[model samples]
Target: MTEIYQKLENIVKKEFISNSLIVRHAYSRVVDPVLQGIPDIVIRPKDAKEISEILKVANEENIPVIPRGGGDDEFGGSKPIGDGGIVLDMKRMDNVLKLDEDNLIVTVEAGISWGKLDEYLCHYGLYTGCMGPGSGMTASVGGGISHQSVGGGGCAKYGACTNQLVSLEVVLPNGDIIETGSQANKFSKIPFNRFGNGPDLAGLFCGDNGIMGVKTKVSLQVFPRPPFAAYKTFLLPRKDRQVSSQIMLDVRRKGIDVYDLMYIMDLIMRVGCDQGMFPMWEQLKKKRGIIFYTVEANSEAELQEKVKQLDTIILDNKCEALGPEISDGNIAKWHYVEQGHWQFYHNLWGMVPALEPLSCECFVPANMYPTILDDIDQWDMEHAKDMEIFTKVTGMRPITGSGPIFLIDGNNVELTCGFTSFPSYYNGENHEGWDELNLKLWKSLMGMLTTKWGVQWYMMGEMASRIMAQLDAYLPDYYKTLKAIKKVLDPKNILSRGKFEFWGDGNK
Candidate 1:
């Protein structure tokens, strides 16, 4: 390991590489309470060429190489699945390479955060559609593309961040650097399209979860920010879950061009208000579920028409409108004008101190979520006995529910459903058996959500990806084809090894 560390140091100067225990320990964990893996070395490469050299060395040594961007991923996608390997930190490569305003395209180093990129684009009155992810303040563009991420503003209009992709520069597991999209043509001077040269190979790297290759550079289409905009929030009647789901379906069915539409469940409203997480809704007499909409347009007429259509759908469903001001429970105004999207998308995770989330993010049809949400309630009841173990120790039962249901592209919605509980090391004490119980409950919930609900998981990281593979959740031919592709692109399985049971020979 020391010799390998020295070899990596030679690739990315000694100052940028570390084998210290403290540094490796820091790279081992992510937002999850689980400690996924420990790294033998952590190296930050400044460019694709340096990453190419590092990958070559790792391939020769048959060592695992995990590419990490920003380390803001909650799914453990950037960490290794084993005890020791090299964690390639990509933050050093953060830079905007180009901005072709004429063509409405912006090229950037993959490690650049969405917030930084947005700030840069805002200077020119442009923005990246889908604005990366809910954690876009620090989540890297590479990580967002790797997961087809959503939940940020404009997801209703732009879908995933990958939807606007024009090109990508990826370093394969075997150290070969290749450009996808129009750049695949050797003589092409600029990347303007994603589908021309041969296949849409850029897609192979998108949402690959760090298994196919390391993303180094990316080019995405930028949209001009509209001048006309309007937002509204509505309080729902009883049976809010079913009612909220219907509102989302109607918004899609009526062809409403909304920028953002979200369903905040009653649990979040009540708990968030009680915990003071939602100051805007403090005065609401009924803390039931609420739905909000944000719309933007090139003209005031278009914006008004969209708002009028949306208001009719929301009001006809027996919902009461909050005041136009954000202070009067109008969260949509704050979400758009004040940049509250990043802060509130995952607020439920911090509803209680020291309670961490074991969550699953997935896409499901708008109509199916009400049933899924109800099933989650039933799931909570079924797990009451197991939850009591935590309640006995901490006097607080684990809280299980779905966070805000975000209306994403098409007729789908993004569901961030999970339970939060005290970590095994709560209050700085290691409680035996707590870790095992947490894993057991997490796996069980994941199994139920996947098998019974048939939801499509977009960000299956170390734990969820492995559990899905182990549970035989995927069809036989689909699994076989994925393995074949992995074998072809990553023969040694050195990149993101052990994911989907693709551990390299003798490594398992």
Candidate 2:
């Protein structure tokens, strides 16, 4: 290991390589409470060339190379799960390489934060079409692309990270550089298109979670920043989950250009009310769900016209408007805190008051939302009884949480619905046992989601890998093909070794 570390230092300079216990420990910890893997060494390469050299060395020596960006992976995708290996930290490569306003695209280094890219583009009256996750402030563009993250702005209109991507420059496992998308053309000057002459190679790497290769540069589609934006909120009556789901489906089917739509359940609202985080809590305490919409347009007139149309849909669906004051205030607060190197969602941690928060997210079809929610509610009721009693007796908060599902796309018959659970504690005396139980329950729930609910999408990390493996029996060829592709691209299994391994190579 010492000899390998010395060789790595020579590849990217001694200052860029670290084998210190503290550094390795920091690299090991992920957002999950219990999932952790310590790497033997960490390397911060300056560019794709440096990364290529590092990969070459690792591949030749048959050492695992885990490519990481931001290191904010909640699913343990960037962690070193195999025997201790090298963590290729990509943060040092942060830079916006180009902003082609004429072509309506921006080329950026893989390590650049989504927040930084948005801030830089705002000055030029442009923004990326697909916004990032809650951790956008710290999450890198490559990391989001690798994970295919959802949420943020424009998701309702533009879909997820892969939808915004136009091209990518990646370093393969054997130290070979390749450009995908329109950029692959020898005469291409800009990455304005996604599909080129042949196969869409860029699409292959989008959500693979770093198992395929190391992305060094990314080109994404950007849109003109809307000058006028409108916000509205509606309260769905309790006992009308079907009606609530139907209303959203109608709004989506109507082709309303909703920039952002968030469905906050009653449980989340109650928690926010107790934490004093939401000012409209008093007015909406009894509501079954709160639906928030942010619509943007080129002019105030256009924005008002869209809002008027949305109003009719809300009224026709028997939903009550929460008024502009409450709705706009909440939207403004989120924007203010999330813009410019901000971490708005961090405040939610205070409510859970946990050292580390554990969450499980899944993407189910839009039509399945109500049924899935009902199933989860039943599961929570049955499983949370013991934790509730334990917390009550110990003077600690119970392990309770909520799942917020948002519709990403509406044009397709099978719309994408992103469901995320609120954070829960997994620490403290006596709580450790509950934590283990909760983890097991969460994993089982994930399995059920993919199997019973027909969920077809997942976020990056080890959980996704496990879910894929769990569902492999239903799609043997799909898993086999993925493994075959992995073998071809990374023959030595050096890059992100044991990650997304569905071939039964002892990774599971």
Candidate 3:
């Protein structure tokens, strides 16, 4: 056994530290099929103390330690980048520490799945406000918070995972255990507050993507479940993207208690049609946009009033109601495929045959949606013709794009827009060749979006380091401060090396 393995074994039990080839291989694999790096060892720590000890040893030896929770991120965040090191799997630490119903707060170990937590909270008629990712069934609480995922039930109302986060118990790279937010207070029994009479230290780790530290536990604010829910669907003219975007803005501006508002673009409709997923695709073939919205209220009267308000806004935007047939069917299918027992693995593993999907989640200005969609369409057309990939003979098409924008804050429409791209590749027989082309296309598209629209990548993983580096150049002082923090917190840079690459050395 290697010296590092010997040291890790001392920190955890021998059963917890495995250097076996099979185990290491399994640990190396992630949701992204294109990116995989086998770690030297896979270590499962049962608690933060064990993680702290492991970090200390890793720091001393200058070995990279990548903390992984669920390994379900579509972006290559959890996968090792530099020379392989240790994969610190936190699944063994799964626990629901406390449920402070009085303050409407829940404290859970980072490794607990969001689905599990939501299930447990349902018994109490309470739920987290944050919109979990489609993979919430297996996606851990720490994973969602670290990545800042935005989608599920709370998209229109409470925003992303970061919004629901109240506090965090993190293990810094130097192996120091620190609690951020109100949890740091001596007399605090519940971490219901976020600011904590300080400069929002908890916010620092919210979207840091595990680059800052390993989140061992998290405290999130919860809300009582709404008693009533309703859904609606609107069909917008194919040529007018602004109408749908405006309608979404109006919903937030009017302070509608919207649970989820999803805008499905034409390209997505076509893809769904191609996959035979949407039977109503024929009717929407000429339509440019379809919107599905879910509103919630404490009473049926309130729900009806909200729906009436939504209808007025829809008609004002020159959108036609597609009736409940489309909306209810889509919502039912969404719940069945996502929240139900169907095991929604299609997000990571491409469901459509011979096609590999890659999504670039971003937060852009609300007003830029139309222009961005236009640009993407133009790019798709040009690239499709040039690459000879979009042909009837090949049964392959251009990179079809769709975005569902969510409001981060109802008060400020400018700050509300969260847009994400769903792009795919038709691999056919040559998987390797197509995968290479897909990666190249994906990077090019990302570069265009970042350069032209100033879109911020939602999942700041290794793939996003270059973009972060460029963004850092625009704010050298801020990045310098971050680098300094990294130096102090992780002197040896053992935790998530090559992530948020602003340090002088690539690994550091």
RMSD of each: 1.3, 3.2, 3.7
Model 2 residue 468 CA deviation (Å) reads 2.4
Model 1 has an lDDT value of 0.88
lDDT of 2 by residue, 57-129 (tens): 8887888888899877776778887448889999888899999988888999999988899889989988887
| Order by lDDT, highest first | 1, 2, 3
Best by TM-score: 1
**Runs in model 3 lying further than 4 Å from the true structure:** 279-288, 325-349, 389-395, 411-436, 470-473, 504-508
Number of backbone-clashing residue pairs for each candidate, in the order shown: 0, 0, 1
| Preferred candidate (lDDT higher): 2 or 3 | 2
lDDT of 1 at 195: 94
Give residue 160's error in model 1 in angstroms: 0.8
Model 3 lDDT tens row, 187-216: 877687888568899887887888889999
Q: Write the per-residue lDDT of candidate 1 for residues 23-133, one digit (tens) a residue.
A: 999999888887478888899999999999999998889898889987867767788876888899988878999999999999999999998999999999999979888
TM-score for each of the candidates: 0.98, 0.91, 0.89
Ranking by TM-score: 1, 2, 3
Model 2 TM-score, all chains together = 0.91
Worst 10 residues of 3 by lDDT: 412-421
- The TM-score of candidate 3 is 0.89
Best candidate, lDDT-wise?
1
- lDDT values of the candidates? 0.88, 0.72, 0.71
